[model samples]
Target: MPQPATGPTEANTFPALCAHTHLFPGARCRLQGLSDPHAFTAAPWSIGVDLRFSDDAAAAAELRTGGPDGPVLAVPPYTTGAGTRIGERAWFVREFTWVDGEVELRIGGHA
Candidate 1:
């Protein structure tokens, strides 16, 4: 059986585990809610998820099958596109975007 992924999202965690059962967080790793929609963050590889909520913060995982799955983004990429106009509650992100020296992913929704 595949063990539930533990610890942060950095690649370092797995390599150490295989060597000496040791794990540590990585520079790009973090913990988040599974099904909270806002809990999901887009990794380089796309992960299957149902229901994305307000904002592009993090995503939450859903145990059951229903609704729609979330799309993979560049963590906090800009949502600007040709003819792009977001509703009052639309979400988007841009690479290398940050505020107060911390990264921020835009979160919003459509009317």
Candidate 2:
């Protein structure tokens, strides 16, 4: 008989896109780069991110028509040998610029 699925299986895994932004899977956006991927501090932090979308025109239009609230990006929790630990963090988009089919977002939040 087949054994039960282990941790972090692809079958139950989802992309790291921010669901709160609603510009993730629906917009075919993929994370391209992050200014600071690993930062451990409580002080206010700001990071720059680059996102590439399959449909540039549509993505730009969506961003323009977004609600008053900015997009929320998060880092999901994970499990380690010690135990499951919360690594979740939320960052609000301070501003975003789209140029040459690339979306650059400046996000800030408490880390």
Which numbered prediction scores highest in TM-score against the true structure? 2
lDDT of 1 by residue, 65-110 (tens): 1114432222222232233333222122222222333223322222
Give one digit per residue, the lDDT tens place, for model 2 in 43-81: 112222232223221111112112345455543443333
Q: Whole-model lDDT, candidate 1?
A: 0.24
Cα distance off (Å), candidate 1, residue 42: 12
Highest lDDT against the true fold, candidate: 2
For model 1, the superposed segments whose C-alpha errors exceed 4 Å read 1-96
Off by over 4 Å in 2: 1-69, 78-86
CA-RMSD of model 1: 16.0
Error of 2 at 69 (Å): 4.4
Residue 107, candidate 1: alpha-carbon lDDT: 24
lDDT of each: 0.24, 0.32
